[model samples]
Target: MIRVLVVEFTRPDAAAVALGRFLRDEGVEVVHAGPVDTAEQILRTAEQEDPDAVVVLGAEPPSLPGFRVFTTAAEAAEWASGGRSHTADAPSDRAR
Candidate 1:
């Protein structure tokens, strides 16, 4: 199964929670990490989870090499569903 790490910089809002559920329903393993303070913390969590992809919400996107950061739950879900590719790196930040 595809493993996705969902990182929230603040308390998870409805959208974040719903994203987790959506990923679960898609048969993807969702690892939720958050309310963390810094980009470093986010990177550490990503490293620990070692997910195939990382979904970041409510914060500036960390410049972590090799990890594609999706700023919205819908974008993340679409990517996770094979509807998007990490190679399309332009416009890296999705509107929250």
Candidate 2:
């Protein structure tokens, strides 16, 4: 099974919770790193968890070498499932 470390840096963490649920539904192992204040903290946690990928919700993605950073759970799911074509069910992209 694919393992993912989810880092939520925003306040109101609802998006992260939703992403965790979505990933779990897709059969991915979700590791909640909780809300962090900096990218350094995320990197440190990633080192410990060593997940296949890292998903960041409600914040800009951090730069983690060897692990891909996905802004949306759907995109991460697709990547974890071997780059399958996405459908309309994908959550809307966050506005820039």
Candidate 3:
């Protein structure tokens, strides 16, 4: 199972919570860290959790090497659910 850490950097973290729930339903291990104040804190938490991916909501993701940063929860959920190839959802230009 894929492991992910959901971090909320802004107020009203409902989106982050929803993301965690969705990930859980998809059979992915979801770790939530909240009330995050700084980028350094995010990094520290990530190191401790050691998740495969980190989802940042309501803020820009910190530059963390070797870790995938997702700006939106939906994107993270899709990836966790094995839909990493976004192109699959894109409309085909050719009409068959």
Best by TM-score: 3
List model 2 lDDT by residue over 1-96, tens digit each.
567888886544677787788778877778999888888888899888867678887677667776668877667766766733222244213211
For 9-65, candidate 1 gives per-residue lDDT tens digits of 755556778899999988878998856778888888887876778888886677878
Ranking by lDDT: 3, 1, 2
Candidate 3 or 1, higher lDDT: 3
Top candidate when judged by lDDT against the true structure:
3
Q: What order do candidates take by TM-score, descending?
A: 3, 1, 2
Model 1's number of clashes is 0
| Candidate number that wins on TM-score, 1 or 2 | 1
Greater-lDDT candidate between 1 and 2: 1
- What TM-score quantifies how close candidate 1 is to the native fold? 0.78
Per residue, candidate 3 scores C-alpha lDDT tens digits across 19-53 of: 88888998877889975878888889988887778
In model 2, the clashing pairs are: none
Residue 94 of model 2 has an lDDT of 21
Candidate lDDT scores, in order, read: 0.76, 0.72, 0.77
